[model samples]
Target: MNKAYVTFRDQKSRDRALAVLDEFRWRKSTLTSKIAEAAPDPIVKAPEMPVTLSFDPDDKTPVNEKVVKSTTPLYNVTYEEQLEQKKKAAYSVMRKLGNEMAKTNPELQQFVRFHKLRRKGQICEVDDIKASPEDVC
Candidate 1:
């Protein structure tokens, strides 16, 4: 049988380790609470109510694409094109948030393993990773 030896430099080193552990615990709890708070509340059933639907043939109107094109300025864009632009903008924002979180959060960075995993073509889910300040130590 083989025995392993373990040692701490002094009382201060032990205290520091304990402090780091406590901080990690506190941060984990805080993250849990924050996640819970951010989650959507469960839906509850309410008393059922009768609903009515009505349609009128006169209300139906066809969109005039030619008229729309004539009215739009040469530089103006369509709604579908604008929506695609917005989606790209939102994606960029999410990527920026992920980068910022990776920079600030060590546990998240660990979970991401950005240096190792990025090379392997793996990406982290931003919301799933929790980081603690003690991770830096």
Candidate 2:
């Protein structure tokens, strides 16, 4: 390991980092640190505050009901209820996504007919042409 420059969100954090670095001991060697001598041309900017993620009861957006139910306290839920919720969630996801995907991608809809024939043993496998890589070096 060589040297590293660490940036902190606040001066307190930077001070703590410097203190830790100053007396840092690794293996049988002790490490030393020093403050930067010059200020940067454009001083480093602190990172933005993280997005607040508190849920609002008034929000109308669709939510995964199963997720909220499953994450509840264990004592309030049963094994059978959890299993049923999982099955419903899985089924709804697959049904919705599959339909939307088929509607958006024409090629998927084209393959649907072939898939039906394949399931009925009306389609046969064909060998794909394999191309050998050409060395251009």
Candidate 3:
């Protein structure tokens, strides 16, 4: 049994294809087809305009063997966003620490108890860690 799904940019093309394919005799067998309703949201979206870049071997640009690239973020982030990202990462690390401390150290249980209680703020909480008191509140 052969099965396939198709999508066209317009409804006219879809209708035409379905009309041509539906109940048509092919290789001594009849074909079954219908206009399938597509979901409101596409499974994956194609970029409006795609750019495909490839390395050029023929173009001679002298490759420097001892060149060091700059260690910079690809996307620009505001100070508040950066701080929030760091806080989320710190919370993840703290949760892992809490799990290990709970199992490994009974001596630190009394100290860890306070942290565990306050975990409602630390665990899974994403907030700007370096914001002013007024801005944070």
Question: What CA root-mean-square deviation does each model show from the true structure?
Answer: 20.3, 21.3, 19.5
Ranking of candidates on lDDT, top first: 3, 2, 1
Using all chains and alpha carbons, the TM-scores for the candidates as numbered come to: 0.29, 0.29, 0.33
Question: lDDT for every model?
Answer: 0.51, 0.61, 0.70
Q: Give the range of the ten consecutive residues with the poorest summed lDDT in model 3.
A: 65-74
Instruction: Give the local distance difference test score of model 2.
Output: 0.61
Q: Using TM-score, give the best candidate's number.
A: 3
lDDT of 1 at 4: 27
Instruction: Report the number of the highest-lDDT candidate.
Output: 3
lDDT of model 3 at residue 26? 90
Question: Each model's number of backbone clashes?
Answer: 0, 0, 0
Which tens-of-lDDT digit does each residue in 31-63 have in candidate 1? 111111234444422324445665566754455
- Model 3: per-residue Cα lDDT over 21-123, one tens digit each: 9999999999988977667554355555476986787956555421221243524677678777778778888777776786797877666667667656342
Clash-forming residue pairs, model 2: none
Evaluated at residue 107, the lDDT of candidate 2 is: 74
Give the per-residue Cα lDDT of candidate 1 at 81: 67
